[model samples]
Target: MTTKIRMTTPLVEMDGDEMTRIIWKMLKQTLIEPYVDLRTEYYDLGLEHRNETNDEVTVAAAHATRRLGVAVKCATVTPNAQRVEEYKLKEMWKSPNGTIRAILDGTVFRVPILVDCIEPFVRTWKKPITLARHAYGDIYRDVEMYIPGKGRAELVFTDGKGGETRLVVHDFEGSGVLLGMHNLDESIANFARACFRFALDMRQDLWFSTKDTISKKYDHRFKDIFAEIFESEYREKFEASRIEYFYTLIDDAVARAVRSEGGFIWACKNYDGDVMSDMVASAFGSLAMMSSVLVSPDGKYEYEAAHGTVTRHYYEHLKGNPTSTNPMATLFAWTGALRKRGELDGLADLAAFADRLERSSLRTIEEGVMTRDLGILSTHPSKKIVGSEEFLREIRLRLEKSGEAGRSCR
Candidate 1:
């Protein structure tokens, strides 16, 4: 029997909703607890509970993450009108992720988890591309209004003294909509530093994009900040690391990304990153194979699956049906949190366990045993499709065998 690894600090575990909540329990029981003497400061961010706490639980969880420095979150439900009615909520609660990102002021980094059996749809791609998304302030926090008729829209800023700056947004001939979105210089600088530091750490080229030609004031601010910070703060270190940083228009960046071989980091605004990450995930494979991490400026990290809660699979699970929902991203989320925790606490054995577990999972899929989604995308000749539970059990077997052999991937 293999002794469980001991943890010095507890991980902040945010439990989510629907099918992922089910898988969360299964993962802890099957693959984790049996091997590691796991410790977690747990928070239930499930939709029903969020509504019960009036979303205070989400705020509390974010604070706990800041206090603990590392968190692993399960995918939660972001309620729309339909979800509000389905879950019978008090009001349409805001996204827990949005609330957390706002409090943490973090940047999201998403990268694809590549396996040997699956080839990317993009023929030229030889490696994984990481997308760094500015996780605060865009249309997400915009204020909008419907014009009654023949009205004008203006953006106004007032100094506390007596000075005021006002600019006309639009003049309406007929009824139209007006929107105002804002971002902070502080947030933009943080985003730039995060990207630069990440690039230096990964030793990859950094590319940033904005539609500065059209939105001169707004988008140009982003470009200017990145350039100034790269020149002032990170240029010498980047030169020492032999990494490059460049800026281009978003459209041109997209075209370059599609044509070029993929081993670099692409930085984008909130909306563009939101859209392009999905496109890149699909072009490479499924969103289930993408790992997401939010890194705050102060070095706090939160790991989560890039995809949503498997709602359809949840319904199937309710009917006592075995579902083949992929758990790759969530598994990585756990490993990432564990690895970070181990590193911070100086626990080499714990860190080694995280590495070995990740290798075991990839080895499982590379050997042609996977869940339904990956099974469809995989071109392995001897494919063996399995349900979620069986797939995890297979991983458990590998974990146990690897543990017994005292194998170390690092």
Candidate 2:
């Protein structure tokens, strides 16, 4: 009997919706199940299932991640008004990413999967750039109102010690807008630590950006916290590792990012990260090839692809049309979660199998076998573009050819 890699801990697996959903199953059937004794605490985050469970399944999955230490998630649909009608959903569901991020108090980090054939548009780019996004409260959870006329907005704080503080945020002049936003020092501290720890793990420099020069208190707090944490806890290790952390104005950071070689982690505020990550994904080639992970301050991790559910492809697939959705990032999600689970559980063989799968996937792309998206962007001209399932099959063949099918990860 061929021995399979043993998994000592169950990874909390969150299944998503649509085309990527289809790819998720293929990933397990072809690449993972054949070699590993798979174990997972499965949560169906599919739109229908989320609705059927009143989204309690998502809550349970997040809790499971906290308990289990690792999770692998598929891309899910964040329903819109149209989707509510289409899926007969109970309500316009919130972003699964947002929901889980709030629960775990985590930061979302995005890193692209670089291949030789896939040349980043930026000529100077080489290594992968990771974005550590503070996905917590900021403008994401802000209260906003459209003012009809002149009005005063106040920031109020009641100490409950018989003293109250009130400051005028803005005095609106004819037909304007108002917003209230705040962040906790504790949350900022946690975000800093996660970014620092992640940068150290990747052995790369960490660059934190904010318009600290303008929004002095708000943005400066982020800068101050990162500086304080590094100086007090991580400076020694960072120096020993020859990696550095620097704070800069967001504009200056963007310019530097465009001109410089890519090998560091860019630490961003909630809104900035949301905007810039899309730019980074496109510049690197495609969102379909980017990997993302949510890392909590307490060390819980959830890995996922950095893209959305391919609704267009899913619709086409529903019509029985061939879909060539890129699966690199999704594949990485599984490998990342498995590797972390293996590390935490001392299952070296499981981790090694993940590593092998990753190499095989990359090798397939490098050899000019790719999906339609990559075939269009890849620098190589000698390419054989195939559908999603066919591409995965090609990867599976290469993985089997690696000659370590039954060997221990050790």
Candidate 3:
């Protein structure tokens, strides 16, 4: 007789497009469905479906995730004007991620894959560096106006209570750039809370960086708010966990990140994260192996592949050709979301399954059975390169062998 296992909660599934969407379906059928009984509520968020639903599907999915507390997503197209014309979209809908993030009120965390054979540009990085980008207002979604002639550009901050006000003036003699950006006190506080939660979750030190020295009044407010939150709310917890929260200037933090060995959580403001995450991705290697997670301040979570739809690879796959697209990140998305779910439910066995799956993936790569991206980085001359399906098969075989070993020990 076989024992039955069940999931306590349903996982919100947002399906996507191109090469990754194809990989996402295959992973579920091959790796996940075989091991666990999942309660999955799926929403078709593919390009055509999104256009058909006018993106209501994405909003509904986000709401479901917020309600269910866990979501696993596949990479989807964030349609631009060109994409709209190419796909013949109805209206250029806002990014599905943007819509969901707005509703969920979360920050996105991106972590790179660290393999033994594929070396990172930052040699000191022994472990993966996870970056949490505060996906709120600053430079992105800002109001801007062109300052014609040499008129003074001023930033005025006014208190909602009384008639108290602060002003910053840019007195220019010639033509120059003038931009105004702002962050709400509420948003910044939530960002700080999320960063601290992520640090606590991962058991890593948290680092926050800003150019407070230059923009003392504006950026300094952010620094001071984060400091106050740390001292008041997180200090005791951080001390107990043996984790530290250090504040540094942006320039200094970048230098240190390059020199220091990786194993810390770095929280960045909106603009900085957008730029820095790309740099980190390049440093690590292929974007194909990068994983992303959205963690709300309220602790709701969603995980997905960080790379895009991989349109080029999808075309090859269309021709019935064996495409060597990397599926590690998508697999990690499932493991990460499930691990968090297991943790929340206090199901150690389920959590162990997630751990085993992750270990199996890494070990498969270590044993020389890998997709093309890592195949190019092969250390052994005898290592034979495999396609995506073949690589997945190799991992499955490794997992089965390990399971047999465990059973034998029992």
TM-score of each model, paired residue for residue: 0.95, 0.92, 0.85
Q: After superposition, how far is residue 391 of candidate 1 from its true place, in Å?
A: 0.5
Q: Model 1, range 1-410, lDDT digits (tens) per residue?
A: 87889999999999999999998999889888988999999999999999999999999999999999999999999999999899999998888888898889989999999988788999999899999999898877778788989988899999999899999988889998888889999999999999999999999999999999999999999999999999989999999999999999999999999998999999999989988888888788898899999999999999999989999999999999989988999999999999999999999988999999998898888777899898888888888999999999999888777745332212
Instruction: Mark the 10 consecutive residues where model 1 has the least summed lDDT.
Output: 401-410
For all candidates in order, the CA lDDT equals 0.92, 0.90, 0.83
Q: Write the per-residue lDDT of candidate 3 for residues 132-178, one digit (tens) a residue.
A: 88876776655667666777777765678766556656877777777
Best-to-worst TM-score order: 1, 2, 3
Residue 39 displacement (Å), model 3: 1.6
* Off by more than 4 A, model 2: 145-151, 170-178, 403-410
lDDT winner among the candidates? 1
Q: Scored by Cα lDDT, where does model 2 land? A: 0.90
- The clash count of every prediction, one per candidate, is 0, 0, 0
Cα miss at 270, model 1 (Å)? 1.5
Model 3 TM-score on a 0 to 1 scale: 0.85
